[model samples]
Target: THIFGKFKFQSKQGSIEDYELGDLIGKGAYGEVFQAVHKETGKNYAIKVYDRYQMTQANKLKSINNEIKIIRRLDHPNLVKLFSVHETVTNIYLVMELVTGVPLSDYIKQK
Candidate 1:
């Protein structure tokens, strides 16, 4: 899920090399979000890449897993839709419906 840069993500399903990451849209304490595209399908997505090593605590990992489940099931027009989840030894990648607007970095900068 390190595709936020040039890293490749491998899951049981397959390599996420199908998509190449574009500009970063958001960054946080643990991870960053990047816009990505499917090479074959030409579809766009917002990929949330989480640094697994940063959330090494058991409780934090559990919380992340729980959040994945919750986001996967959520259906809302305003919220990003979870399209897929891919995890590796280092990161967790959340493939989501791309919604454009303000970047989190800008919001944080204003605060």
Candidate 2:
């Protein structure tokens, strides 16, 4: 069973089963973010999937939870809006607005 990159079908929060997984758009220290489409709505979203093992080892549990709390309240054009949260035993998923453009890191480098 892979903990990284792979998504789990079983869940309690929101089910990843609702979304059709697509190519990875970005990655962080804990996991990767992928482009996903709602199986029912046909709408695209960016799903940030984090590995629980890496998050625990990196000690990001508190910060990650805090970020989720803060991000949920925020709504802006510049910010990617959070739609829903999903979790399986091994991974956490954040479904967010799909903002297409150059990667922020690449854009910063170009500037």
Candidate 3:
């Protein structure tokens, strides 16, 4: 089955042309988050790239919509802002505010 089989939205719905992606910052169960810069504005951001294969394996297809919904509603100093979403046949990209700091979960796990 195509990984996008269960997705309510279509793939390749948007473009990644505006931002130049940089180094990877973190890896999650279905994706890797990277540092990115907007080409025209030069603003920095964190972009999460979710692999279609990984999402299918992890059963996170619906989580994509859920994530976008949650991120769009968040308004807090500590939470990064969601800027946009870009996609391809095999990957989903989440453009977000660049937030620099040790993740609380990681910090706590070290204790």
Candidate 4:
């Protein structure tokens, strides 16, 4: 079976004209996260776009599925909220709330 076959995810494959993508915030094992702002709502969000080809080959489709499931189940103030997910032909974009805080590593080093 093909990877990502179980889940039918559709990405907002529109041009970059809708939102302003800012500086890179963090990079993880799967992909990079960026600070972004919605042009119409003026809302801030962190966009995490994963590398489709790499993820598929690595068979980490479960990770992507789990992320969506976990985010959907969570609803608490202490938790960062997941706004939406857009899956394109080559990437999966996860739109999430932007939380401003010092990284744990930075905080630990200061103390």
All candidates' TM-scores? 0.75, 0.84, 0.78, 0.80
Local distance difference test, candidate 4:
0.77
Return the clash pairs for model 3, or none. Answer: none
Q: Which candidate, 2 or 3, would have the higher lDDT against the true structure?
A: 2
Instruction: Output the number of the TM-score-best candidate.
Output: 2
Model 2, position 22: C-alpha lDDT score:
99
Task: Identify the runs in model 1 with alpha carbons over 4 angstroms from their true place.
Answer: 1-14, 57-59, 104-111
Model 1, C-alpha of 40: deviation from truth (Å): 0.8
Ranking of candidates on TM-score, top first: 2, 4, 3, 1
Query: How many residue pairs in model 4 have overlapping backbones?
Result: 2
For 1-111, candidate 2 gives per-residue lDDT tens digits of 423222235545347889999999998888899999999889999999988888889998777777888898888788989877766778888888998999988999999
Whole-model Cα lDDT of every candidate shown, in order? 0.76, 0.81, 0.78, 0.77
Q: Model 4 over residues 1-111: C-alpha lDDT tens digits? A: 324343335434343345688989999888998999999889898888898888889998788888788987999998888777666677877778898889768899999
| Model 3 per-residue lDDT tens digits across residues 12-50 | 523476789999999877789999998888989899898
Ranking by lDDT: 2, 3, 4, 1
* Each candidate: RMSD: 6.0, 5.2, 4.2, 3.5
